[model samples]
Target: MNSSALVKHISECFIKPQYEVEEANKPVYLAPMDLVMLSVHYIQKGLLFTKPPSNSDDQISFSTPEFLESLKESLSHTLVYFYPLAGQLATQVDEARQESLVFVDCNKGPGARLVHATIDMTVSDILTPRHVPAVVQSFFDHDRAVNHDGHHMSLLTIQVTELLDGVFIGCSMNHALGDGTSYWNFWNVWSEIHMAKNRTDLVIPSSHLPIHNRWFPDGHDAPILLPFTRHDQFVSRYEAPPLAERIFHFSPESMSRLKSKANKDHQKIYTDSKRMISSFQALSALCWRSIIRAIRLPDDQVTNCRLAANNRHRLDPPLPENYFGNCINAITTTTTVSELHEHSLGWAASMLHQSVANHTNKALQDFLKRWLKSPFVYQIHQLFDSNSVMMGSSPRFDMYGNEFGLGKPVAVRSGYAHKFTGKVTSYQGYEGGGSVDLEICLPPHAMEALESDEEFMGAVSLPLTGY
Candidate 1:
């Protein structure tokens, strides 16, 4: 779909945290999990909502100016609790120590960015297409390249795009700031504050309050320094190969069918009745199998799938669900193409389930110890491979529920950052229930093969993604 030619950029400004940070702007050191993501791209996602009906209560009857002001105001309040995001990433070079450390500098008063834009198009124009419109990228603020770029830019950007009969709130958060769990947690709190009548006096429940303390090993110091004098010395973003991305929506019934089939076939080998296949495992297995078949790799060729697991619960003393930071590790499961494509979906799921189960508390502790010994940074080459598939994001996030005084989102979309071949991100289906949506990125020929694969298409719900 072609976007309207009249795309106008209105205004851009920074929205600081409502309250001043304590200790005269002390630095908050990032943990190993956050530091490893320094080379990745910022996460870009947005929500689409239609124009609210004119109800007598006038809940959403404000004009464009009023709407933008309220969002900016509420965001300031949100940033007060999520104070780290309101700060900038800083590099402290220590010539004596022969190292440099990256930390969040809340001093000097940097703030989240608020960008206002206007585009002459309806919400339907963005949501109706099978492949999302390229114009959606314009809804975001930065033509951002990498998280390392956060050292000199706004760590968080909120661009509100005014539509013909609707509005879109697009966001771009530095990957180093947090993972999807932390990202969605901030969004949920912001929406909650926005929905309140007395926004200032509203008390955030303990359940929703975020804990900002960064995690570390027992003997480690506050900020772990890397053996590099400059940021560019160890961190750089490379050009990723061109890829095609598409979202596939599966209904509750279809999801249940896949889960049941996976469990049913798994019973053939193991009698472990208590350990049935999970919805995540089942769906991931299906995606892995379908992609391997579609790619048409040789029988002996090895293919790997990396599943990201949240470490909050796995920690010895579990962190609070609202603990705001990156606490995730990718669990890689490898298999030959023939082993994956020829076997029942259940077998592949079992492999993934065991991989996740094996990543217990001990494994995470050892990983922390190893990371402290050698603070290695990730690059594009180390992150992706031709024969590997990596998965991020989760279906459990409260994305559809982030109303922000408007109605619930009509759809959830992502920007062009972090796109690599065989990367899949999952979200709860727009209709709720047990439905799921997998946003998949792949090579052009592989995507064509997937679209035509009968086994994968047979389970997809009717009318696919759009409402």
Candidate 2:
């Protein structure tokens, strides 16, 4: 759609009545996962042939304020639809507590290149697969880009691109918007409803998980469950240029071999939940170590890496699927740069596994619940350690199957990272079954090191069994 039409469409969307919460007086609580908004950042780009578009008049374009208001309208709908969820989470997040508002900024300088719209990133990098071909190329170049920080406030931005045609659309959703699965479901449904002009029949189906928070007295006060503050320590303002993305495909056969080689009894394990994180853990450790070594940082410099974990399953009562916001935390494991240089894949994988296992215990969960309710949260934000690299698996994004009846996503990608949080990586199920695709953003040197590492290359050859 052209910028003008998109603006009108947005204004019309906002004309609809806002939804009211059943209980307006309840305290707005923040979910553990909501903290991502504070750390989330965005970078987008558009690619074109040398000739560019001959149809100059038909190219995507947007005036700054028009684009911002357009985003404001869409977000308003999102806020109203998920009001209760936001209201509850708001009690915890600073931005959400202020009201369900989305923030917008205009990017007019070279520094603005840090974050790009989702559509621009995907289209410019990954090839659009036929199965998920609904590439909304026009949207990214024309619509406003929104970034949500930890405070749960959306920072909306608009970039005037030189693109003569096509489109780019992207948004950095707070982790609180549910996992990639939940977000896509909500997005698909929202788009359907919006496009249909009020057709409720197109709404997405929900499995309906339980919707209340549980305070497990039994799970509190565990020594290993220490709270680390991410707020003050991790600032989420500046944008960085899009780090080059390297996609690696894994085959099932290689994965089986790796698992067999690592297993004690020579038994084969073939489950997605158990092995996904473990495999990635091994790979990530290897990757992290290799990068550190290549950089030639002092051996004494610690290289701590973390895996983000969703506490929904670990909780006594699982959070509702539609909670619509961040609801997870991380499992941090530290290693001396020297230690990783000498360890084998099995050893690193074990470290990663144990770190996660340690957190899954009752003590961690209990401590987390109590910690959230206590005043310690203020103190924790003061401790942002610089030695860590954070990576998470987003294998839950079923891009190809997220068919909106217009074909599936031609390409799927998670957004960018802020300056403070360190490196971030997200893995997704590729077009081929058993094949996986990975998106990574790290310091430029780290990317170069991975490209030259032989061991990392071996791991990349591993098989993709299934999602």
TM-score (all chains, Cα) for each model? 0.95, 0.61
- Model 2 misplacement above 4 A: 1-27, 31-81, 84-167, 175-185, 188-198, 202-204, 208-245, 251-258, 264-277, 369-387, 419-422, 461-467
lDDT of 1 by residue, 7-52 (tens): 5789989988887867326788888898988888888888888877
Tell me the lDDT of model 2 at 70: 44
Tens digits of lDDT, candidate 2, 94-133: 3433322221111111111112222223233234321112
RMSD of candidate 1 to the true fold? 2.1
TM-score of 1: 0.95
Predicted model with the maximum TM-score: 1
Please list the residue runs of candidate 1 whose C-alpha ends up more than 4 Å from where it truly belongs after superposition: 1-7, 55-62, 272-274, 463-467
